[model samples]
Target: MYSHLLIPIDGSPLSMGAMQTAMAFARDAGAEVTVLTVVEPFHIFTVSPEQLQAKRGEYERQARAHAADLLAAAEREAKLLGVRCEVVQVESDDPYLVIVETASKRGCDLIAMASHGRRGIAALLLGSVTLKVLTHSKVPVLVYR
Candidate 1:
């Protein structure tokens, strides 16, 4: 019953599976898809201004390139499924915030993403983005392991 689906990808194998599942669901529901990849902002202390600027530029370039590659593959998959798709790449320190905000801004009814399945201390240390998104997002979330 969803009209628009938002799928977040991190280039992980699990995320790829989520993408496939989301695409199939979108095709079945005649829904368009929006794929999002959030790149973390580069930050470092104890660096000269010039060095900091150079490093920041380099980091952004590399991150955008990686996001583009990931989004391209998703786009190709959507095309194969005959589903309309759009791609978004954003820089944010908090990916969950970006995912939630993008879903709201794009008017998506559903969010489909993969959980890294981290648990216990690892989950506490590495903070699951999927969990955060589920907690914070108003849109319906369908998570795939």
Candidate 2:
């Protein structure tokens, strides 16, 4: 049985669904869950420092706010399920790597997340963070598709 579970979410319907499922699983196992939301740094090709500064600041604010909202909702749900929960937010260009590292650092026995179910060219272009986490993480991953 898992003593701790790490659930990474992107605020998507799929990820939210997975989070709910993982929360239930954690409650059943008498395990706590850490809900993680990784906000990617804003990327832009602006030569003007003023524009870059302003836009990047705005993006950062919005991203963190959204992450906060998501985490709050998750916390409420966890409370309703009577499961202990911890929430974390971080900025990283590589969210998948962050997820793996956080799982290890938090001593999580399992990493549960949703898969986007990408295929072929679309997957190649957009890339799949879930796939990367599965490939790179040493912790066991439970993928919800």
Candidate 3:
């Protein structure tokens, strides 16, 4: 019943699987897809202020390029499936916030994402963005593990 789907990609194999799943779902539902890739802002606390400022631009550029490439692949796959796709790249320290905001702002009816299935200490330390999105997003979330 979803007319618009939002899919977040991290360029991992699991994320790719989610992309494929979302594509098929979108095709079947006759829905448009919005592919989002969030890039983490660069942080180097050890560096001096000047050094950090100098390197920030380059770091951000590289990150944006990587995100764009990831979104491009998703777009291509969705196009092949005859699904309309839009790509978004955002730079944020809190990806979950960006994901939720983008979903709401874009008027997506559903968010389809992949969970890394991290558990125990790893999950505690790194934290799961998908989990955060599910917790915070107002829109419906469809997580593919």
Candidate 4:
């Protein structure tokens, strides 16, 4: 009987699927949903200040556009399900931290997201955001595979 459910998505197929699944659950529970998309800041290894200045602006601009498109699509999905929806976009290097903080700040009763199955080296490189959220979140977390 959650009043507000937080769904975090990254536009991956698994995350999108989790969004759909959680939206259905929200509809059934008569709970409003908040869809969050967190964009990690772009990393650059170059030493040129000019390159850094130029590329950082472009990277953020595109990331913002992409997040907007992704959130808009999610809003449409929620509308189709007749579930009240709000969308949030955040930029951070630590996505799991952002997700947890957003859930607490928004007063979301639950955090639902996909368990992106990255293994070994890939997991190490990308970091298991879902696991981090599970470990750190005070709110309940529902993970969909």
Model 2 regions more than 4 Å off: 46-54, 117-123
Predicted candidate 3 versus true structure: per-residue lDDT over 6-41, tens digit per residue: 998988888889889989999999999999988876
Ranking by TM-score: 2, 4, 1, 3
Candidate 4 has what TM-score? Answer: 0.88
How displaced is residue 74 in candidate 2, in Å?
Answer: 1.0
lDDT of 2 by residue, 1-145 (tens): 8999999998888899999999999999999999999986777864434336667778778889999999998999899999999999999978889999999999999999999632335457758889899999999999997
Name the lDDT of candidate 3.
0.85
lDDT of 1 by residue, 12-105 (tens): 8888888999999999999999999887667786233433766778877877888899999999999999999999999887889999999999
Q: Is candidate 1 or candidate 3 better by lDDT?
A: 1
- lDDT of all the models against the reference? 0.87, 0.88, 0.85, 0.88
Q: What is the lDDT of residue 18 in candidate 2?
A: 94
Number of backbone clashes in candidate 3 = 0
lDDT value, residue 55 of candidate 1: 75
In candidate 3, residue 105 scores what lDDT?
Answer: 96
Model 4 residue pairs with clashes? none
Residue 128, model 1: Cα distance from true site in angstroms: 0.6
Looking at model 2, the pairs that clash are: none
Superposed Cα deviation of residue 46, candidate 4 (Å): 9.0
Tens-place lDDT per residue, model 4, 1-145, is: 7989999998888889999999999999999999999876777864334337657778778788888998998999999999999999999878889999999999999999999732335467666989999999999999999
